[model samples]
Target: MENSLNSIFISLYAQRIQVLFAVIGVTITCLVLYCYRKRKPGICGNLRFSKVAYNSITVDWDRACYTTHYRVFLRKPLEGEKWRSFKTKNDTCSFTIKNLPINTNFVFSVCACNGTVQGPLCKESEVISTQNLAFKMKGISILREETLPNYIPVYDVPFRVERNGQLKVRKVTIGDYPKGGAHQVKSILFVSIPHSGHTTHLQGVMNFIFGVSTKDDFRLGFSSDITKKSDEYKNWATVYQFVEYEGGRLDKPLTLVDIPRMHGPKKEQLMMIHEQLKYILELYEQRLDCICFVGPANSNNLSPEEIDFLESIMYLFPNDQSSDLSTDISCFFTFADAGPACLENGLKSSSVKNFKSYFVNWSAFFRETNEFSDSFWNMNIKSLDNFFNHLNASKPKTLRLTLEGEPPAPQKKENVWKLQPEVKEDVANLQMTKTNGENFIDNKTKLTYNLQFFVYNGGNQTN
Candidate 1:
């Protein structure tokens, strides 16, 4: 009887264990099914910027099937601050947020919501700001001005430096624009001290103003054949005529012919340079309207000898020329006399008393940060813009003509023509001209000329 009782107990225990396992497996299956039925959907994708302005930006994202609405979040990345959020209707995927700060960087993200349920935030977001908008638009106007024949180079840069310590200069005839034109062109030359980064900075300023790189800007084709062919100066010669000095010092006069000799020239050699430079400037003055001299701050301060050289060139070249040559042949002057390379207080050149001089600060771009501080690149851009505008400054005049979007009602009487109001077409037309207006057609631009004022502040030109 004792053995049979023990067997029964063991069998019962085994049966109980089997039942427990079966129940546990069934419970696990039910739990998994319940979780699957209530899973959350994913967030939207393809977030982008549709439009950007000085005070507003329009952002959009891809639509999600389960989403009934979307939430947009924005904040300035540089300023570690709380995010500002907004909502958009389910049917609407784009939101034009307004009343934002100017020149401030912002990052945007979006999240999707399905009535009571919300999905995860978008994996990608757009970073944008309403800065440089005006600069971009202003570049189009400058591009239009550049199309006129006068704005084109009247003479090619004299010589191009070669990599193998050779100078390549060919005698190519640069032709003038047709006899008659609506506007006069002004020519300017920019020369810099060695290793000042002036060339690079000037190129950057041009790119910023025109809103284009060398490859994209159509005007780059107007560069001289030597400039386009020269690897050492292809980009520098694109916008302005770049002149480089090979000699150790500029305290004495020099010319392209004298640049081959790296050693210091004696007094007799200096006299020869003076004569040759005078002759070259005379030739250049016939075509050039103004000449800009820039000395970028470098490791070495501007030596007294260099200052003497610059002064001699500035005063001696333009003013000491034969007075009876031509009444309109004087070259207006502008100089960046001081920079990080030299910390001199002021410049006094007996030859040029009224020219413009700027003490440009040193600012560089950092690739690791992918940005320039507020006082750096942006400051450079502003300073350059101001300087260029000053070069072409003209008083603004009021026009009675209305843009395409305005009502058809006539404004006050003015000499301006009654323009047809077609905002969309006009804007598109302007953009097209800015991109492709390098050709001179009958000495004038094919694009419509909207601005009424043309200022020639740099040089003198008489018809």
Candidate 2:
């Protein structure tokens, strides 16, 4: 009886031990599943470098669900350096790494973390090279008046073309207008930097708008070979007049003034061109419809000369209080060979108020077809049609011709011609004193008065 009782006790103990073991196994499995659930969020997605500077970079990534935070790891792949880690808060999606070496290639990866559990790392980002800070430091240095000897107002010097002969002005009647009919008038000024293909583009514009071939029109007086004598082209501002008609009735009479390239060897010559342009506009006695700047579509940034030209335009045509009188500024880009990125960069870098830019890939299209081909002419017509349509839809502001006493402040004094209304009386008084042979004012004041008056009166000789 004692043996049987011991066996029963052993059997009961064995069954109890088996049950305890099963419970322990189930508890371990449950713990494992819980730990896995905490780490199942995911690695960050779409990791990219948002901004890159000389010594710093900003990395951004999409947020993951159930993520408490993100950890970014950066390293120089070329140097085989150990990764440097940075942690961000749960709401943060971007991290900026600073004090990094410039002009170095960098790669980065990001991972998500839920409290203590970390998720898998994302695919590494493409290598990005930091910028060279030295290029940013280099800037255009301006020469001061004191640095130049015998510095005189640029307007005091006559244009080489004016001295050689009367500047050529051509007029043509375009459109189908019935004789003895009233017509509206519109004027546009075209300005550009050197080597921007301004003349060719202007010829295309004239052909498109007026259906007149300006290429061989001797009356237009455009340089026969601008490439061979670019310097001569810069010495004169070619002017043209086009009278428009619609349905046998007179319409807008368009005056297209092709200003000389705003860049040249002598700063004085550039200023002279600017002043002469102002004089020409004053003679119009009407507001300009647009001042279009022609440039290459591949340009990513404006040169110092281009910037100066833009600032001069702002001074010449200030924003009037009336919306109707505000000058419409536009940029025309020719030969879009570099693609949209360059165009976007150009627009972003332009300092003009109304950032309207138009472009045509004429060079590219022409390369595939002959000049006499229908497609070549159609392309030019279509591009210009779109540009004009946009201009009409936008209700381009009219540019007032009268020079204001004060213009928008300029970065360089040489870029603008400042005038005061009181100067008119002062100039009259100075002239009277000079006639009387009396020293009414000091030489410095007398010269200032004469210079200011000279520019104020459209660079004309005052009586």
Candidate 3:
């Protein structure tokens, strides 16, 4: 009986140990889950300003987990104003705060939200001041007084192809007037071969600029309806102009030029294509700020015609070896939704790789499924926003308009004038006399003398 009692005690002890181990395992799992819950949710970071204008500030951030949408807060901290909050669509990582007062400092912050629950605010916020129009006007005045005389008013001339196959430029006021009138205007040109997703890329850029996704309501200026189907003009170039304003003042004006596909099977057809391009260049005076080459992401290599077209553009606007940052040539590989492997393969083509080595101003490969889904549209829009932001920051080298057979004008070499000791002394004396209002010559004579001196010494100048 004692032995039987000992055996029962042993069995009971074993059962107790087993139960304790099961409890420990449950506790460990609970602890792990608690730690994960604490670490994973509501960690949005890297709030940054994507674009700042006279009346709007666009902010973007890294995506956060468990976020249904994001809340952006704007306030004038110095004025002690209440924080104004704007909520973005679900899963959106960027927001534009519009109609803000110009020349005023404002603070911006972002936080992730899951329904009624708010996550932690971004670790840091940015302070930005809206562009002041008075300062801008002053800068414009300075530019007009000191810079080149080629500053043509934006969108004052329109290029039209007459029925007789002649290109004509007519003076016509075009585009919408921003509330206060646009202080800055930028123009972009798109070039591509047929079946290269050029139209789709242009449409995406338009959607981003107009802040609209649908083509049904896409209109430029008063007329120029984009929704209408135009099969007859499919082979012709199209121009689009738009204006952005805030508080009845112009914020920015933008122009887009869509060149027809550069593809021709016959010699005459090729000649016609070249002639059209030449006319367009003449109309714009070759002052385009950006030139984007669009291609399909599915293509393995560029066609011979496409290669020739790219060469033509490069010849017209040769790369500026003097400065690495002055190139205006950009490349866009559209219809890239085929996944990463396909995109990589397409970029590896000999023609694409060779072109990228030289035309490296900016490049983007984006998916264009032409889908109505909000997610897809947002993704592409973000990519375009990045592209434009980069373009705006970089200064593009100026281009000279040239015809098919005419050679591009030689790049102007910077003249370095090394004056002789006697000439330098004379120049110093002249400057001092001019400043002192003594021994001053007549304005005409002085100008004539200066021109003669420069012309006589021009041969001695070094590049």
Per-residue lDDT tens digits of candidate 2, residues 120-197?
899999998765422111111112223223221111101112222344222333333435665555667787876678
Model 1: per-residue lDDT, tens digit, 256-314? 12121111433343343344333334444333334455554333334444444444333
Largest lDDT belongs to which candidate? Answer: 2
TM per candidate comes to 0.32, 0.42, 0.42
lDDT, candidate 2, equals 0.58
User: Which runs of model 1 end up more than 4 angstroms from their true locations?
Assistant: 1-186, 212-285, 298-301, 315-346, 349-353, 359-363, 366-372, 393-463
Worst 10 residues of 2 by lDDT: 151-160
Q: Report clash pairs, candidate 2.
A: none
- Rank the models by lDDT, top first: 2, 3, 1
The residue pairs that clash in candidate 3, if any, are 179-248, 180-249, 180-250
lDDT against the true structure, each candidate: 0.44, 0.58, 0.55
> Candidate 3's error at 310, in angstroms?
2.4
lDDT of 1 at 131: 41
Clash counts for the predictions, in order: 6, 0, 3
Candidate 2 Cα deviation (angstroms), residue 416: 23
TM-score, predicted candidate 1 vs. hidden true structure: 0.32
